[model samples]
Target: MNILELRKKAVQLRKRTWELIYNHKNGHTGSDLSCTDILVALYYNVLNQTPETVGTLEADTYIQSKGHAVEIWYEVLADKGYIDRDDLEKGYSTFNSPYIGHPTTDVKGMEFHTGSLGHGLGLGVGVALAAKMNSLKKHTYVLMGDGEQAEGSIWEAAMAASNYNLDNLTAIIDHNDLQITGTTDSVMRSNPISNKYEAFGWNVIEVDGNDLAALIHVLTSENNTGKPRLIVANTVKGKGITVAENRADWHHKVPSQEEFEEGIRELDAQMEALNHE
Candidate 1:
């Protein structure tokens, strides 16, 4: 898809996501909105895996380490036909529903169960390492939260990725800078993450994560450096809706009826504008 197409899909997903969260009365609202673009770009453009292609050892792998934002992921997967759209919209976050707040192996598109914050990169490293040993062409992409950087285990995984020279591994940090409690700056000082990754032998690249074109370029770039690549995606905590953008309180909070309406209007305007563009 072109940039405009990707942008429209993102807005559409955001509209559905707002409905899901507002109606269900659950979700990491800010976190889900913040990473929607990146997820959209991947599912629509970068990833070679599809509903039929996923699960094979040789297929491209995507792991949502920042799994609290699973609502957006579920929407993208549904849109891509990896999972049933109606099943997700109807059963999400309800009793006996498999569409929980985090990614689970029970889900059609999920490769690993995630939500424990700092374990995703390690799992990706393991997959990439195995792929390398088998001389497979698969690439493993892990999307992690900036707040998750505080976990010591993530660093250990970083070291392992480097040590193995896993060029097929790509780790993306959704650096929205806010957590459930407050700003990541105040909760834990994990800034200068790029330089830290560089020291760990990762080819660090920083970009406006909310920018679809930029994300596509960086995500699709070749890694000639023979090291794992890391993208520091600078993004707002709540990206699409003006009322929630950068608001720490919105991290895991449900929107009031008034706020939900306002957000839907904003996303609708965005979709219309993209059509004109």
Candidate 2:
């Protein structure tokens, strides 16, 4: 898909995100909205894996380390033919549903059950190292929330990734800067994120996470430096929605019917503007 098409899809994802949360009456709304563009860029335009390749060792792997935002991931997986869209919309977060609050292997595209913060990078390192050990041409990409960066294990994985020189490994931080209680700055101060990763001997690239064109360009860029890659994606929590944008309370707050309708209208306007552009 072209950049314009991806942009439109992102808007749709944002709207769908709201719908899912509104219907289910629970989700990491702000966090999910914040990273929709990153997920869209990776699944639709960047990753070398498809629904078929996703199950094989030869395919690139992705893990949502910040798993509370699994709603958006589920949507992307369904769109990519990895899961049934009807099943997702109906069974998500329901009792006995595979679509729990986090990414799970029971879902067709998920490689691991993630929801416990800070373990994703470590898992990605293991996968990347295994690929190297077997001489496989696979990449491991892990998406993390900036709030989750407060966990010490992420740094440990960073150090290991650099020590092993895992060029096929990539970590994309959804640096929306908002957590459940407050701003990431006020919560844990993981600022200077790029410098922190660079100090750990990884290649760091910062970009506007919501910009699909920019995300696609950066995510698809070639890497020959033999170093692990980190993209600090600065984003707005609850991005593309007027009321929830950058608001901390929307972290897990479900929107009322009016708010949901308003959010959809706002996304529609953005999509229309992008279409014209």
- Model 1 lDDT per residue over 195-227, tens place: 999999999999999999999999888998999
- lDDT tens digits, residue span 94-211, model 2: 8999988888899999999999999999999999999999999999999999989999999999999999999999999999889988988898999989999999999999999999
Local distance difference test, candidate 2: 0.92
Give each model a TM-score: 0.99, 0.98
Number of backbone collisions per candidate: 0, 0
Which candidate has the highest TM-score of all?
A: 1
List the lowest-lDDT window of 10 residues for candidate 2. Answer: 48-57
lDDT of each: 0.93, 0.92
TM-score of model 2 (CA atoms): 0.98
